[model samples]
Target: MINPALQPLSDYTFARLARMLDGIAPAAGKRPILLSVGEPQIQPPAFAAEAIAAGSHLWNKYPPPKGDAAFLGAVTDWLTTRYGLPAGMLDTERHVTSISGTREALYQLGFLAVPERKNGRQPVILMPNPLYHSYRGAAMLGRAEPVYMNATPENGFLPALDEVAPEILERTALCFLCTPTNPQGRVASLDYLKRAIELAREYDFMLAVDECYAEIYRGVPPAGGLQAAAALGGSLKNIVVLHSLSKRSSGPGLRSGFMAGDPELVGRYAEYIMFGSASTPLPIQHAATALWKDEAHVESNRAHYAENWRIATQVLGNKKGYHEAEAGFFVCMPADDAEALTKQIWREQAVKIVPVGLMAREDAEGVNPGDPYVRIALVYDAETTEEGLRRIAPYF
Candidate 1:
């Protein structure tokens, strides 16, 4: 067998889920509840179906690698409107490119950023400790040292700029920042983002901001990368923001997203994809364009997630770490030990939740930042989440 490190990291999250539920048959007496994966249970917008159906003829032809003109323009318009970027902030001819979804684009970026060395030393890829798994995989595939910055509670669950020690930034090749961060459901404020962008420019490393969860906030709209770019003199020079229709439109199956950044990098990534990536299928592109043009459906999807969070806080309100999720769908609640609680919940209540450790890794520091907390993705509807919490409160 090949070395395990050569295998994909994503498989670990699910494989652990499988083992946790091993040989455990679901109780026929009660329906099983899943609060593990982030896949949204809400119905996707109707426009997606309509758009894809209208573009049925395009299915017969191979999608052009760079994306169709309409798709590209819809993408640029979205960047402008959502982040309030000035006109021409992103020149589509050089600045924008499409991917099947964020995963591939994000992972591929490691290959684009990491070089053999910086000052004759192995380049580093900076990532928040409890980060999206793809970011780590990107660093490994790029052959750069994956430097983990603890995004634990003390840091507001946000990576700290001042704490990045000057040495790491100097040797850094790329830094991945996921706002409205996964599991934690924390958003990096605008000041935080601007500071990170400034650090990236000073260190001369790429700033990759994963804003896939940008559309699902609770109270205030999120401060996105494009907004940060506008503040940083309206340039997409050191920034790369990745957005997807999956979370934005609850259309993960469509597998559509785009990246806007330094035109040189975007063009390079698109070129790299041309030889390897099956371009976002034209039908999917059409659906995505329609999604970008219409915000009504996104508002509805956002409401569903917001409702689920409200239901979560109502049930688990008094429990430790139960602040209403500010953004994204996951809730991070204090647990004695995530692995133990995960199994206990499945065996006793038949409710499936992922251990926070599965979503994070232990660095040389011997601390998995997300440990002692289980990540509950409120992926179901109001009723289902309420029931899951009702059963969950007992175990915690």
Candidate 2:
């Protein structure tokens, strides 16, 4: 019943996994170890639970269409500290809006940003090819061309912005880049982000950087879009960065994140969300506000992930393509043949993994960007993850 704008959107990997195994049980009542989805199994912060309970008194009142003032201030303070921004870089009142998570904001960007024409051509949404499908879906639904750029190892796992043809830039309306990227776990450096922001300014498009995985890393905290924006200047002009409590606080159920950038875009996004947006519930918003303000739990969560990474390295060791992720909890390693390997692991080992082909798109360069790869999510509790590895280790 929805319009044609949404008719061609591709199914997400998890949905496909659901369909492929329909009418099937995982090894006679055993829910086969699932290392396919990135949902975190880390225990959520204690303060979040307390905040939610404490804020329950406000449930009778309708939540603000824009988030509560204190909530916005909390986000602003966190940003100021996290990125060391000049006070004006993010105005608590005008430059930030709360979304359930980056995923929803990323999806809604298509509705707000995509246009019929830019410089007299179909608008383009430039993205890393094997990307979060929302970028492409938003492009298609908004009636724009989707420009696929290679973000694989040969390009240092960052899209080659300079290599893009000028013609494409003329019509580009939006560009999405993720730091500590999904599946591959590649972290974009500060220099890379500065170049990207420069390109967005030069080409006249909005740069939407996804920094959800910024908190989980091997060494120091991952370089974020906010840091890039700050380094370029204290002003958040052409860029909006989205960060979440999902990975940082181990609370995906909270479905909360903040988008901070240009005041004009934030104002417009607030309007769009006034009708179409799913705002976080008041108690949940309070919980998120608390989570953002406190970093103690976040540090503990990061340590846990690091420990998990150690366990992962010890189990898988250094096989071909077993590169250490600079950030994030995923390992993108090649399978001899992705689908065949997934099928083999599912049937023979009773373990489920997603084939990379379903996660990426093919381009004119004849690259199935996800080909020969299987994405493993180190998202489970340590014991479950160990069980998953014990079952699928043979493939590696």
Candidate 1 per-residue lDDT, tens place, 1-396, comes to 766665656455777679767887765577889888899888787878988999999888988777888999999998898888898887877888888889988888888877889767889999887777889889878888888888777888887778888987889989999988887878888888999889988889999999999999877899998798798798777888999988988888888999888887888887787677779889889988888999898888888887887787778888766777678888888887788888878877878888888777787778888787888888887888898889888776
List, residue by residue over 31-81, the lDDT tens digit for candidate 2. Answer: 678788888887887778999999899888766766899889999999888
Off by over 4 Å in 2: 21-25, 28-31
Cα lDDT of all candidates, in order? 0.84, 0.82
TM per candidate comes to: 0.96, 0.95
| lDDT of prediction 2 | 0.82
Candidate 2, residue 12: the lDDT equals 70
Error of 2 at 318 (Å): 3.4
Best by TM-score: 1
